[model samples]
Target chain A: MPFSISLTVNGVSRNVELDDPRVTLLDLLRERLDLPGTKKGCDRGQCGACTVLVDGRRVNSCLALALSHDGAEITTIEGVAQGDELHPVQAAFIAHDAFQCGFCTPGQIMSAIGLINEGQAGDDPERIREAMSGNLCRCAAYVGIVDAVIEAQKRLADAGRREAA
Target chain B: MKTFDYVRPATIAEAVAASAAPGAAYLASGTNLLDLMKVGAARPDRLIDITHIAGLDHIDWLADGGVRIGALVRNADLAHDPAFVRAYPAVAEALLSGASAQLRNAATGGGNLLQRTRCAYFGDPASACNKREPGSGCDALGGENRLHAVLGWSPSCIAVHPSDFCVPLVALDAVAEIEGRAGRREIPLESLYCLPGDAPQRETVLEPGDLIVALRLADPTAFARHARYLKLRERTSYAFAVVSAAAALAMEEGRIRQARLALGGVAAKPWRARAAEDILAGARPGETIFRRAAEAALADARPSGDNAYKIELARRIIVRALTLAAAGTPQRLPALPASPFSSAPGARHAA
Candidate 1:
């Protein structure tokens, strides 16, 4: 009862075998592909600790079945960094000390990256708060997380200006 | 998750045939089904994967201003579409208020409507939930009854429907466009959700072989401009509501013309407050009338001992929601509902 799913993970073509009907993309990454950066916090959809990008939108991989994502282009936390360079949002998280214990960091970073890329995280502080509300930091360090997003947007704007110049 | 056979069909006809057998459930996004499977609540021996169905992801707007949202339409797409967010803000808001951005990205509009209850008894493997295991007896009646239903409660079941999107659909008079082996049927969104009577297991009216093709909605009227979804929850994000109200009102010169009132997190189905609507139809939109309407809405609310607070909270939510919808001054929700513990939006939840 196994089905073969053709999907691209982090820009690489993959033909993975899917069985069990309930085996999710998170399992395909953590167990099969050994890309464990997408942590399974709740396994249930309650926790956003397993967020990844399917077709450039953030999704809780823990609940996304592998077969459902066949031929989908998925991006995990591991794919955010290009070669040795860090994605601006990831670098900002570290610089701002946005997380503690760091269990939820990968999912947090993934969600933030998705928001920034989607252009939903705007200049308004309230909008930033609303956009990032999904990624929960149990440490309750939301102020830092908000600051990190603002800084990330500023850095992107600055980078855009330099490129234009 | 238990082992099961998986068949991914590329067409609705193929999917319908594949799911005709017993214990074969239609697989969409698996955001909800997978969770049920993981907890042993749902043990579908076979899952017919219909996500591969071609052209099922398209959202088509009819020339009559109606919207036809494919069952495969992701919540993220519904939430972000300019047409939906503008014309049907209540639907968009409901989609956005559900789960999280990440969860919504994977959860389809069909899956969101079909999500089971979040009652503690239903979710926990060891607890006795009649909805989870029919005739097992609902332990929620005595144990952890705070989050249980206040409306549409029977001895057999007390669980609430967990979809945030269905509330708005109920208010908007949406229809479920479904197809199956026999033929197709258009079920009113209101009739699509069944209240838990003796059998609490059957959440939707969908037949065994039926495949939900799309959630169809009528054209938005000027009344839509005043429509909004106001939810009372613990956190500002990714939370279910303690009591959520979706109100669509058409006001004519500071007075109520017609109003639709639907309540969530307080009933087995997305509970529509018809009596409240009757009270609001001709009355002037004021706090006093709103309170009276809220009273009418909750007049029949039967709350378990531990969850009686939900009765009051639910009444307040309906009042506040209707008031705002009447005035067309949408209230910015301070906190989303479904915060169990923590210094969140008032310890006023749980009923």
Candidate 2:
């Protein structure tokens, strides 16, 4: 039987009615709610292309059932930018040319934001590489991706310090 | 994916009662189950979402200095927990080494423990996998047997259990607390997994409607402090193990006092290297002694033509893991060189 569940998508309240219970969060976001920022690479959980933040933690949206997350506060790549300005991680990706073809940019940006929130995006390139290992860039732009994450971490840290002072 | 009746029960009793219905299965995280469903491996008519069951998501410390990890504890949370990482670093390392961060954040403890094998035949419905459809001839017997079992396999099926957590849990002497129609019972983690005898369909000893409540670990012995988990995969991260070893050692007067060892990717279940541990008990800790122990562990290995490299690869991994364990170092040895065996995609080979 199909069920409708309320979810906090990005920042707005959403009550999506599912005609099929098997509709994954990836399909619900892209097809149902018209949120296409979260890209689906491999429908399976192997690829991290469908990564999104659920309750401040990054999870592959492809594997999650829509009903399983009844009231989860979901934040996709579309929600990252504030007004007209891009998030620091998004800006860093552009400044460093972290992506080519740009298909995986949304998931990569979301994963980087999650890595920083999870307190794992240190200034170390190797550590950033390991943390971001989930989000695969088929274009082999890992060098720039790692550099962008490191640079973004520094910028965020500096901005936090300034805010504190 | 098959559309099934989904019920989110708020309590364990309600969850258990709901799961007792015909063709019902519990869903937690759904990392493995949902994938299997998509592949036509699992066709449940009803799903009891146990993620909301109260008190089933905690990491509690027992009064006996052991740890009781609830079934719903996500892999990332357990891996990142300061206390869990400090107490059982090998367990945490094993969890972190298997899947990606996104998967780890969604996968739960019990689900990880009960995950099915990654054998190509098992996942493909067209393939003759006895695990998926009993009485179907084992297609992997003659085709793409590289990922098949090297130990404790029957002619009926040769698939190995692909759980990274079970390797270290077997070394740590963990027990799973199960709830079923009868009542709650504690079973040693070793006995919980049954070898693929003639009945390849019966993976675990879990009966219908049986649910794993939590896993209880014994107090970390001195050996646990100097432990290491070495997983040799095709790549460094986000890959299943071709051969993995979990080794723990307790040194006394510079001699081996106690040792615990377990091997994965070469067995029907997590094969505890009891013979290796016996060899290391009174022997000195060195290259030659560790090599002998590793040899003793693989004495009964029966490898197929495509996976014969696993025997030698696993032997070297055991010795290297033991060496690191003895030194109390967490640094993993570099992955072995590419194998001479056929590295063709297992799914491409037709029966």
Candidate 3:
């Protein structure tokens, strides 16, 4: 049975036909839609390499079945930046050198964005470390990741303040 | 993962009806369920996706000071709810302490209660697990069973229930509203989990096609002022508790009027320490009384495997949790949430 579902992926609406119910959002994005930026690390929920924004919240796309998210808006790594302008989190990751192999970079960036939007961790390094503990970096880049998140949060807050002013 | 027929039920009634078939399971967030399927621990032929069901995502404050939390309410949302946090600080703390931010964002309250144990043998199909397959021999009895249960265990199975959120709910005497093929009914949250006695596979009391709609906590304001959830884990965060405790006290003047205590990672269910609560009811707040309460809490705890250390750890945690609760809940939750280091003197200052 082919199930047809509609989703708004990275600001574009897409209608998809899933031939198997076992197809996860990670596979749907990387394989069918050709959005390969969302890396599949564990395929299980243990690793956050498959993290993405579903309805503005970070979730493990590998654990999310595509059919379950019909009509929902999703934001992946491919949607985080404007043309020729990097998102604050992405820019901060590069500035801090937060990645070595860059396999977990996409998930870390998306999780950082989600954490910043949640507004729970505000320049607190401990809080940022705790919040970003989900996206593990095997390269031992946690020091850089924490610094990057703190810097990105400050940047995003400053940008918001400027817009408000 | 096995290919399954997915049905998105529009209503709870339809969901319950669709789940009546054999080899059918309810799919909410799939944080735990999908992982189990990927490991071949769970193989359901039909999945009834109940995430689309409306009216099950609300957190309603009842007129009688109680609160009803819908089954579909995400763990992160519930933990971050200001009013809910104020009323049930221990619950919120416990919720925040369990999983990572992303997992908490996707995991639901009802699904948290139903999450299976993290026993390595149970996740491996090659190993014999009584909880996974009833008649199969228990491999965890002799395998790497350092983190197995200590309070309640039988020769059949020793896997502990791995839910941090449930420990505080059981301590608060939360009630579960369930709907089934027969009708709607309510049961105490403590009664929902069954001891692994002989039927390890039948972990919960829910029958087939039974769905948990909401969890109701009755008037938690009395203990809200002095409630604390303290978890001892291998790491500071994103780790399961080696032994965790939730302690809430309603004090009168300088004496303890009432106490609620429960332990996690020690038994098949959140082991409510009724005897410990009884011992602390009229006692003065001190280390001596707290020690007695801790001893009473672990009086029946016996190790199932190489986890004799957990019994002592559980006792010390109960004592520390009671002491922390008597001190009072923090003005805001600690940056580390329920970790013991969070409440260490000068810990926040050092941070």
lDDT of 1 by residue, B1-351 (tens): 678878888888888898867789888888788888888888898888888788888899999989899998988888788877777877777777777777777788887778888887888879887788888888888777787789888888888887889998988888998897788889998898878899888877888898888998888876677776777776666678878888888888878888888988898889888898899898788879888988999999888648899999888777666655665623332233222221322222333
Which ranges of candidate 1 are over 4 A from the true structure? A18-21, A160-165, B329-351
Q: Rank the candidates by TM-score, best first.
A: 3, 2, 1
Could you give the interface RMSD of each candidate, to one decimal? 2.5, 3.0, 0.8
**Candidate 1 docking class:** medium
Give the C-alpha miss distance for residue B342 in model 2, angstroms.
26
What are the per-residue Cα lDDT tens digits for candidate 2 across B1-351? Answer: 777998999987788889878899999999998988988888889999998788888999998989999999999899888888778878887887878888889999999989989989899988998889999889999899887788898888889889888899998889999998888999999999988889999988898888999999978757656787877788767888899899888788888889999998998799899999999997778889988999999999987548888898899888777877776734331122111121222111111
Residues B241-338, candidate 3, lDDT per residue (tens digit)? 89999999999998899999999999999999999999999989888999899999989888888999999888888878888888888888889998
lDDT scores for all predictions? 0.81, 0.85, 0.92
TM-score of the A chain in model 3: 0.98
Q: Which ten residues in a row have the lowest lDDT in candidate 2 chain A?
A: A120-129
Q: What residue pairs are clashing in model 1?
A: B232-B337, B233-B336, B233-B337
**Model 3 Cα shift for residue B60 (angstroms):** 0.3
* C-alpha RMSD for every candidate: 3.5, 5.1, 1.8
User: Against the true structure, what is model 2's DockQ?
Assistant: 0.59
Better of 1 and 2 by lDDT: 2
Sorted by DockQ (best first), the order is 3, 1, 2
Runs in model 2 lying further than 4 Å from the true structure: B331-351
- Mark the 10 consecutive residues where model 3 chain B has the least summed lDDT: B342-351
In candidate 1, what fraction of native interface contacts survive? 0.83
